[model samples]
Target: MELFSDDFTDGNALAGPLREIFAVDMTTATGRCAGCGDEGPVAGMKVYAHAPGLVARCPSCQQVLMRLVRGPSSAWLDLRGTMSLRIPMPAE
Candidate 1:
């Protein structure tokens, strides 16, 4: 599914639509933060995922952040605005 939008905010908002497109368990999805250089849960952070992967939000600066981003890994959305970091799924 397409990622990000002028109207998008939280990851939960895209979870349903994203799952419909990727057909993956968007509920258990997780990723690191490319903005704060931290890795953790992706719950409260605004997020979005596409063919590239997931884009978790950084809860520190509210930037459209990402994580573990190297070659073909999942992307992330920066959620530093509402919180420090979020993990929708339970810690592993």
Candidate 2:
């Protein structure tokens, strides 16, 4: 049997889906880890895509930052593990 390692990609993998929810790019947003209080860009988080949903974890403490699941008619986004997300916007 093949063992699973820490083979994962950066949070950039979420850009496509996240764009469907928000008008702006979410990969550039900053997320604060609720578990370790570490803050970094969403693109810097570790993303495991071999599962049913996308699991994003904090790089500092390996804490779950968010989970996104998409279906035919709906999508579920859980960000409870993330303290807050600082999304940059264009000047109005």
Number of the top lDDT candidate: 2
Candidate 1 residues lying further than 4 Å off, grouped into runs, are 1-9, 47-56, 66-92
Residue 76, candidate 2: Cα error in Å is 0.2
Residue 38 displacement in candidate 2 (angstroms): 0.5
Q: For residues 26-80, could you state the per-residue lDDT of candidate 1 as single tens digits?
A: 5445555555565444445555544354455565555665332324444443234
TM-score for each of the candidates: 0.42, 0.93
Clashing pairs in 2: none
- Each model's lDDT comes to 0.48, 0.95
Candidate 1 structure lDDT? 0.48
Q: Tens digits of per-residue lDDT for model 2 on 1-92?
A: 55577889999999998999999999999999999999999999999999999999999898999999999999999999999999999988
Error (Å) of candidate 2 at residue 5 is: 1.8
Name the TM-score of candidate 2: 0.93
